[model samples]
Target: MSTPPPRRASAAVASPTAPLIGLGAGAPVLAFDVGGTDIKGALFGEDGHIRCLARIPTPVAGDRTGQAVIAEIVNLAGRFAEVQPSVNPRALGLVVPGHIDTRSGTAVFAENMGWKDVAFRERVSALTGLPVHFGHDVRAAGGAEFRLGAATGLRDVVVVVIGTGIAGALFVDGRPYDGDGLAGEIGHAKVASGPTCACGGTGCLEAVASAAAIARRYSALTGAQVAGAKEVLDRSQAGDPDAKLVWKDAVDALALSFSHVVALLAPEAIVVGGGLAEAGPALLSPLTARLDEYLTFQRRPRILAARLGENAGLLGAAIGARELMVAGGTR
Candidate 1:
C-alpha cells in the first residue's frame, strides 16, 4: 500500500524556532520530542535541513494520555505535510521522556506524563504508515551532542540535561551505552540524604540540584517565591545570602554526583544542557572546582554548555528517523 500524496502547504515554516546547522545531506524525516508539557515537531528535508519547526502544547488526557499524545503526533504529521506536499517524509523519529525500551519501541513509564506500556514505535508506524524510530528524550539529545555538538570528537562523554529535572546520556568509545534503557540515570544517584525526589527516592541528585529544585530550595530558605532557578541564580549573584546558600548546595550535590560519574564511567567530557546550563561559567566553574576537590588522581571531565540548546533532542529524533530509512525498516 502507498500513501496518497499530501496537499501542499501554503507557507514554508511559520515559526522557525531552531536553527538549521550541523545537519548535512540525509533522508527527509519528521521528528518530535515530546516532553511533559510541550512537544517539539520538526520537518527535515532530503537535504538534511530543517524546513519547519513548531512547538505544540502536550494534551493532558488523564488515562488516555499515551493515546492522546499519539493522536497529536499523527495530526502534526499531517500539518507538516500541508506545509510541503512535495517533500513527503519517509520516516519519523519520536522521543519521549521516560523509561523507554528502544528495542521494543515501548514507553515503559513516565510519572509526569501519565503514560505506561505504550508501544510508540508500533503505534506511530501503523498510524502514519511510516517507519518510526523511538527513543528516550535525554539519551537522544545526548546522541546529538555526541555527534555534532559539545562532545564532538570525544570518545567518552556524558550529556547532562538540567531542566525542571535532570537526566544524562552516556557515551563510551564513541557510541551510546544504554544498559537496556537504564544506563545514564545520573539524576537518581544519591548525592545527599536530604530532600525526597519525585521518584520516591531519598537524596536523588535532581531533587537537590535540578533547576526546579534550586528555585524551590531558595524559596524555602528565604521565604520568597522565585520564578525559576535563573531568578535564584540572579539573586545569588546580586549578593542575596539565602539565594547563595541554595545555589551552593545545589552545586555541591551536582559535583558529588559528577564525581561518581567520573569515577565510574570516566567520561572525558560532561556536556551540560537544558535550562540550568544557561548559567554558563557560573555553573561549570563552581562544578569543576568542587569536582576537583572530590577526586584524587582521577580524570576531571571538561564541562561545557551544549551548543544545540533545546533542539538537541529534535535533532537526535531526526537522526534516528533517517537511520530507520537507511536500515530499510518500515511498517
Candidate 2:
C-alpha cells in the first residue's frame, strides 16, 4: 500500500523557476548523474566551469522507465540549450542512486535503475522547464565531500564510494546526515560473511567490498577471466597469490566496513572514492593497517582520498541546484 508516484500521475506543474546562487550567479547548473549504465550530463559553468559533459545509455527498465529517465533529462536539456547558447542555463540538478525521498522529490527505490515510487522532482521539473535539484547519489557525493571534497574541514565525516557499487555519505557538523531519508544507506551495512545482497541484504558492505565485488569475487575465486577492479589491483601488484587473496579480502572488507563506520560515526574522516580509490598506496597502506586492526575504543577516522574525481556527483548536483537557488525554492 505505498505506490502512488509516477510524477503524481501528471499533475504537472513545473514553471516556478527558482535556482541560482554562487558558482558565480546563474546560467549553468544542469548536472545529472542517474546511473545503472549512464546518463551523466553536465554544464556547471558560471566559471566554476564544467561543460556539456555527456554519457547517454540508461533506458531499459520499466514503469515508463521513470518517465523515460525524465525524458532523457529533457533531451539533455535540449542539448544544453543548443550546445551553450551563451550559457544561460536556468537550473537543474539531479543525482540518483536509490531509495531517495529527499523531502518527496521521491524515487523511493532504484535498484540499479529498476525504479519505484518515482516522482523525480515533478518529472524533472515537468520536462526541463528547469528548477529540478534532487539528490542521493551517495548522498550527493556525501554532500560533495562535506562541501568541497575530501571531507573538507572534517567534523565527523564518512564519504566512501568504492564504486561499480558501494555507497556512503554521512556528516554531522558539516551537515548532510539525512536519517529520515534513511541516512546514508552505508552500502547495505552488514559486513560480509557470506554473500547475498542486491539490497535484500545478508552480508552487505556491498556484497563484500565493491568494485563490482572485487571483480565478482575474483571471478568467483580463480576460474580465470579478470578485467575490472584494476585487474585485482594489477594482480596484487604482480605478486599474485590469487591477487593477494583478493586484495586481502577487499581490504579486509573495507577495513571491516571502516570499523563499523568508525564505531558508529565518530567520524573525523573516511573519504575514499570510486574506482577502487585508484589503489593509491595500494589502497591507503593496507587501509591504514586494517583500520588499525579494527580499532579498539574508536576515534580513528582519518582515511581520506577522494578529492572530487568523476565530478563528485556532478559537483553535488550543482551544489544541490545551488541549494534550490538559495532556498527561494526554484525561484
Candidate 3:
C-alpha cells in the first residue's frame, strides 16, 4: 500500500479564504461521494465552488468483485473532465461507506457493498492519473459539518446520519476521529432487546431507528406497504396509530443511543443528518425530550439538524482532495 503524503496542519483547519491562495485561486479538485444506492460526484473549482455536479446509480449489481464500482467512478471522472475541459483536476477525493481505513486508503469492508480490503486510493489514482485521498463517507460528512456546516466552531461534536443505516462521525477536540476505521458504529449499538439487525445483531440501533427501519416496522405492524420513512411520518401525522407507534420507537431508540453518546463524549453538540433528519422538529423535538429523560447529570449536547443536506458528503470530499494537494507539497 502506498502511503499518502503528510498534509499541512493548516490545510485541515484553514478558513474558507485559505484554499484560494495559489494558482490564481487554487487548483480544481475532483470529489466523489459513494453511497449504497448512488454515487454523487462534483468538481470543485479554483474559487471553492462546486461545478459539474452529477449523481448516478452505484455500479454494484454484477460487479461483485468491486472492479465495476471503480470503473464507474473512473468513467464519471472522465465525463467530468470532458465537461469542464478548462479545469484540470490536480487531486481527487473519494468517500465511501463501510469500514474504511482512511490512513491506509482502503475500503476495509462494506457489508452492503460486499467489498473487502479494496485499495481505493491506489486504484482510483492509477485509473485517473491523479493524487487521491480516500475517506469514510460518514466521517467525511462529519468533517464537512465541522468545517463549513452545522458543527462549525464546535470543539467536541458528534454528527450522526440516519438514512438506510445510522452512522456517526465523531469530532473530538475539533478533529474527526476514525479510531482506526472502527470508532463510530453507533448504528450497530444495541438499543433494545428486540428485533434483529441485518448485521446479525439483536436490537441494533439501525434496525430500530433508521429511516428504513421506521418504514419496515410500520409495514410489519399495519400490513400497509409504504414508500419510505417519509410516508410513515406522514401517516403518523395523519393519525395512524401504527405509524405513530413505529415513529415513536425509532425516536426512542435514537434517544437511547444518543444518551450513551452524551454520557461518554460530552460533546457540545450533535448534528443529525440523513433522510430521517428531514422530518425536522418532528424528530428533533421528541428526540431532545426523550434524551433528557435518559440523562440525569450528564452534560446535555445541543441537538441540531444538519444544514448541508445531501451535499455534505460531496463538499467533504472536496475538502479532503484539497488537503491532498497541499499534502503532496503543492501550493
Residues 78-130 of candidate 1: C-alpha lDDT, one tens digit per residue: 98888778888989999999898888899999989878899999999999999
CA RMSD of all predictions: 5.3, 16.3, 7.7
Residue-pair clash count for candidate 2: 4
Which regions in candidate 3 have their CA more than 4 angstroms from the true location? 1-25, 63-65, 329-331
* Tens-digit lDDT string for candidate 2 (143-243): 87677777777777888888887777788876777787776667787876768887687888777778887778888888777888788788878887887
In candidate 3, list every pair of residues with a backbone clash.
Answer: none
Q: Which stretches in model 2 have alpha-carbon errors above 4 Å?
A: 1-21, 24-27, 33-67, 70-72, 75-87, 90-94, 98-112, 115-136, 154-157, 160-166, 169-185, 189-200, 203-258, 261-267, 270-315, 319-331
Top lDDT model = 1
Q: Number of clashing residue pairs in every model?
A: 1, 4, 0
- In candidate 2, residue 324 scores what lDDT? 79
216 in model 3: Cα distance from truth in Å?
Answer: 0.6
Model 3, position 51, has a per-residue lDDT of 58
Top candidate, metric TM-score: 1
Q: How many residue pairs in model 3 have overlapping backbones?
A: 0
Q: What's each prediction's TM-score?
A: 0.94, 0.35, 0.90
**Which of 1 and 3 is ahead in lDDT?**
1
What RMSD does model 1 have?
5.3
lDDT for residue 45 in candidate 2, whole number 0-100: 73
